[model samples]
Target: MITRLGLIKTSLIDYPGKVAAVLFTAGCNFYCPYCHNPELVSGPVPEDFLSMEDILRFLEKRRPVLGGVVITGGEPLLHPDIGVLTGAIRDLGLEIKIDTNGSFPAKLEQLRPDFVAMDIKTSFSNYSRVLPSGTAAEQIVRKIRESLKILIGNGIPHQLRTTIVPGIVAEEDFDMIIPEVRGADSYLLSGYRNQRTLDSSWAEVDPYPAEVLEGIAEKLRLAGVPAQIRTN
Candidate 1:
């Protein structure tokens, strides 16, 4: 029973140019305060979770109209049966994109989804602040580094993302991350929304102003990084 915590029957923005269905898997290893999907992160899976059979049946019927599926989470890679879910989606002849938190490099390398969108939460130096306290910081850093290596080495159609939370991620942080992801396929910066964050205090944190985000995007573009601010 792969936990299908939430589902968006249709989405125009998840899979790049493809119209896709978004499936939310449950549980995440990280405890980023800005995470909006707290329910899927640590809360119980909602009673309305669609079973694997149910999702497959829906896909079978929608396959003719949808181009692919976007398997996101709380961190889809946290699920041990992620491969099973991806395999079933592949069997339906629709492309698959997994939105992960860049913590499961080996699993990602092995599964090889059609597209991957991983979040680079913060600079390596400030990693501990965003991740859970007392976490094995060095190990987590290594995993994210390895995931970046795998994505680039395998030439996976992927995008590296960052959410610009006002206090957690600043414009200067981009200077640290840009070099690491330099010359990658694409880099996206998303403005943080605090309305439903994992931490209640985060709800009071202000998002970066629009001009600030766009300014950083332009700076990255000028620096030769394929950077853009994702509006969706």
Candidate 2:
């Protein structure tokens, strides 16, 4: 079952050019230290988590005001019944956007979302730093690569994003990432927040300044990738 952990009745920034409802799902494959929604990453779903029916009912009522729905996580794609959830949303005539880590290429290819935001945590070579110890980092990297191809080849409107964490990702790493997402529709560089991170120690780390991130985005644009910085 897909666990519906939280919901934002309305959001203007989560979905581009639309006033949308945001659904938060539970569970994640990667354990990035700077993850802000650490509580949703693992552990049992809270007793009060809304049932799938509850979520659909809520959407039904709000259909008149909402332009779309943003299904985010804890990697929404991790849930086996994610397609069912998306299908239900689509039936409401609401556009759907999914936020993912791009770890599940096969599953991603099965669903058609109006928009996709895939986090490129770091260079594929350094993915081991965020994943579990027993994970096959190389294999996961290959899957991410495949997912990228699926998005580009299918002509999906998507953005490749990376949070500029202090130590986890440096400007140099973009050199490796550029080759992987060279032809992506867009590349987003987000400033990291140091609070409520998955790893408490990450709170002590400083994020890159806005100018620093702007510089990096400029570099990406010069290299032929459409790059933008998201401050929120």
Candidate number achieving the greatest TM-score relative to the actual structure = 2
Q: What lDDT tens digits, residue by residue, belong to model 1 across residues 101-197?
A: 8889989999999999989888888888677778987899899999999998879999988898887778888788877777678889899888898
lDDT of 2 by residue, 87-193 (tens): 99999999999999999988888997999999999888899988987999999999999999999889989988999887788898988888888888999899988
In candidate 2 the C-alpha lDDT for residue 138 amounts to 93
Where does model 1 exceed 4 Å of error?
A: none
- For model 2, name the residue pairs that clash: none
Q: What is the TM-score of each candidate against the true structure?
A: 0.96, 0.96
CA displacement after TM-score superposition, residue 50 of candidate 2 (Å): 1.5
For all candidates in order, the CA lDDT equals 0.87, 0.89
